[model samples]
Target: MNTTSTNCYLLAIESSCDDTAAAILLNDKVLSNVVATQEIHEQYGGVVPELASRAHQQNIVPVVTAALRQANIDKNELNAIAFTSGPGLLGSLLVGTSFAKSLALGLNIPLIDVNHMQAHILAHFIDEEGYDKPTFPFLAMTISGGHTQIVRVDDYFRMSVIGETIDDAVGEAFDKSAKLLGLPYPGGPLIDQWAAKGNPKAFPFTKPRVDGLNFSFSGLKTQIMYFVQKQVQQNPDFVSQHLADVCASIQYTIVGILMDKLKKAVKQTGINQIAIGGGVSANKGIREALTQAEKNLGWKTFLPKFEYTTDNAGMIGIVGYLKYSQELKDKNNYIDTGIHAQSRLKL
Candidate 1:
């Protein structure tokens, strides 16, 4: 270990999905965050695991180098190297994991393994001038392409997932619904864009009645498919004419389903402070809905900026800094050197 406690520097890498990101944090303050998004995935409706891994191999080195250069820090100044250890694509995780391990070994520094999901939640703690950090025991709704869960965070590492999706994630719902409208590969953003111009109540889609906090979007997805199929058969140009309405209605339903469960979670836990993370948190509908809830319900809500909401190394760096700080508080809390990537590692 470097044993350089003062002015600690950490380099964090995230390759959980198609994005290869790197960030440099100095004493919990992120100085540089660089993300290389794969455009090749735009051709495919969804990510191809093999291609994602290959892209990571090509981007990881340059991304990390750029991050360090931007941060105006030398590799030798890094006290520890942190990398996402999973709850992500196995192939993608390997590229980051291998790079982190090699760098730590070369520099004779400590290696910190971060859980991607946990990183998303802890991202709120990344040092920002005006951003407010959520208090302890706040509820964090992590919604993204691959995962969706409502978690109760008692501390940095102590989190309990109270609710989660049983089938497809909300991001998938948006994308799949967009595909039905003949939208491109990443239909989620398009849906959001079109939804902005149309009436949310123009069309009413059935929302699945899921018990408790566990969600089921498969039924809602099927409902959209059947509805679209029927409309297309009647008028081949239906999608073209009603694109905005369809997007608005779909976004409305998805946002409603999420908000309903979030309200229930707050009622159940009695913890009013709500925070959201992950990529889907960037949706305007969800953000507006949550903000409205705060006004009507007198709840404190935390929403990260657009850049931090997505899969990026800034979040990973925050987790790394938190974990390192925890270890410093108690040597017994130190991360084991044998830590390895886990595709389904729980929060």
Candidate 2:
């Protein structure tokens, strides 16, 4: 699509997982971001693909409507429709993809495809009055339920995955650890909350010695499991007695692992600018850890607002706006409207 106009209006949809989110972007400004969370998965302990997709179907329309209403924009004014196209549950991605395609076609607008993982990184650019955007050649560490990666972003579309988890992501490690402690679904946040009240060094857990920036959290999970089991054997109420300590120790280990890798990336890439995105970034421990890095390591950090930190359409709209700007710069930079949802799409 080619547009010589400025301040283009974009409607973005995100149903990559359990949340059905919609947002409106006027140029780089995010006017509205509405996410309908799926609490139905709470009882199940994790997201159930089938249930997530079903909930998305039920929430998409109203979510989009609310987003537009909040943004005070009409569908007819949209220059394009952007939607997350991959690296998510196929069923969930399809819900957003189908809806975006239909709406784009109905309004005769172009369809913009966004990678779920990339959106997590580009989320740093979502408009905030005084927020400073990260310059190119920066390192972006995206830690989420499905991904943990260190990316070298040279430009809008020029990104390279420098390192990533070979097995489980940091978010999974947190949630799984919480499960071992009898916490509820999406226990990552709960762990963070409790971690605040306990000593992070209360318990000792061996950190994985993975070479380079590649992460391995499966072993950490196993360590916690066995440790918890042994404690329970000694005392049936061990978890209940030390819930806060357990959470703090676990969060401490995870944050250390992440910060160590981030420091290594900075040293290896010589990129002083570091940014983090995804749901895991919302953890208070991780946020403080990263903030401390700026003072100790002379590094500049970018952290998105809590709302944009999680899976949301506002991030998708940022990508759409970037791609649209590319088209404006060079008409030959045409985006493929023929794109489809890719469940395992790479960043």
Candidate 3:
């Protein structure tokens, strides 16, 4: 496994969730990234793990094929295969891990395992024009449907989690609040859209008083549910009448909670450089707040491109390329065939 050459082609697969994705990376640059989102979970109001895994089983092959075709690279040209191996649904992870293992075995290339959360942070390292990579000793906040954590990143593979959610993640809080408002599945974005037109202070919600940098959103979700129930009981048309106001207030509170913790992380670590990732990082409200922090708080914020902010193989490919490059110095960068999927992996 001598990858001393400048050109290293890697195929990355990501099925850690409902999206079945694949990407081709030439070193640190992405050639093509393909994602097939599953809409089957919409009827359930949230992701059904069984349905998600089934969809991944059906989409993985075509998704990988499409990625290769889009990259104009033959499968034989790949030097390594990488797949997300943990911190996701067991069934979904197995689909990707099995495929990546078989592909690497057949092609006789290196098989690399990527931690999903680590990929979210390292996505910043992708060689994208106009985007500056964060230097070492930066704070990374990963907010997603299943996770919420603030990490201390010292190097490419050196990371430590400083704080995390004790209960529901911030994304869950957003989606669950949207559900209470009678919004459709995957409703976080819709709330953001409506919040823009309404007054964020129209209906104020109290931010949870959690200690330290750790977060707790389950209480906030409960508060929203109770408020919605009481309002609807008094007036059946309350939600319809105050939809925008409710959305604005909710978004404002959630953003406040995130910013508060980030401020604490910075003060505790004395690091002004901040980076955010995961699906929720794409929220307009969060992005706006981070941008404002740049001007108001004098904090250096790093945001990934909209496409890389979500669950995609482009991020996974970047991690793969990074790990492959590290293999030259560390012989333990590759995974054995006995490697299995992990549903809960920490950074």
Question: Which numbered prediction scores highest in TM-score against the true structure?
Answer: 3
RMSD to the hidden true structure, all candidates? 1.5, 1.8, 1.5
lDDT of 1 by residue, 205-303 (tens): 988998999888889999999999999999999999998988999999999999999999999999999999999999999999999999999899999
Residues 197-266, model 2: lDDT tens digits:
8988899999999999999999999999999999999999999999999999999999999999999999
Supply the TM-score for candidate 2: 0.96
Sliding window of 10 residues with minimal summed lDDT for model 1: 328-337
TM-score of 3: 0.97
Give all TM-scores, in the order shown. 0.97, 0.96, 0.97
Instruction: After the best TM-score superposition of candidate 2, give how far the Cα of residue 97 lies from its true spot, in angstroms.
Output: 0.7
Q: Rank the candidates by TM-score, best first.
A: 3, 1, 2
List lDDT for all candidates, in order: 0.91, 0.91, 0.93
Please name the candidate that would achieve the greatest lDDT relative to the true structure: 3
- lDDT, model 1, position 184: 94
Pairs that collide in candidate 2 are: none
Estimate, for each residue in 1-347, the C-alpha lDDT of model 3 and write its tens digit: 33467688899999998999999999999999899999999999999999999999999999999999999989988888889999899999999999999998887788999999999999999999999899998999999999999999999999999999999998899999999999998988889989998999998888999899999999999989999999999999999999999999999999999999999999999999999999999999999999999999999999999889999999999898888887756534485898889998887
In the predicted model 1, the residue pairs found to clash are none
Candidate 1, residue 266: the lDDT equals 95
